[model samples]
Target: MTISVNGEKKVFEKAQMSVRELLDALEYKVGFAVALNTTFVLNTTYETTMIKDGDALDILAPVQGG
Candidate 1:
């Protein structure tokens, strides 16, 4: 399956995977919020949430600014 991560398209070994699994696969830090196709996915739901083909994901973290 093909999914776009931070604007870069990449192929995955499989299409069915939870958000947590996906992040784990990419080694993303746990402090970030996940956006699936522009929608926010709850962190608690990541374990049950499934990502599919052509999905666009953006993992954003809090930034400090004054």
Candidate 2:
């Protein structure tokens, strides 16, 4: 399956994947927000949210400045 991650194109071998799986694949360990096709995905829903082809996922992390 092909999807866009943070504006970059990425293809996965599987036809579908959960949000949690995607995060793990990306090695995301810290707090962040996930938006699928402009829709916000709750952290609690990560395990249930399924990603499909042509989907756009935006992973955003908070930044701190001095």
lDDT of each: 0.90, 0.96
lDDT of 2 by residue, 1-66 (tens): 999999999999999999999999989987899999999999999999999999999999988999
**In candidate 1, residue 9 scores what lDDT?**
94
By TM-score, how accurate is candidate 2? Answer: 0.93
Tell me how candidate 1 scores on lDDT: 0.90
Per-residue lDDT of model 1, residues 10-65, tens digit only:
78989578899899999987688889999999988999989999999999988999
Per-residue error (Å), model 2, residue 46 = 0.2
Q: What is the C-alpha RMSD of each candidate to the true structure, in Å?
A: 0.9, 1.2
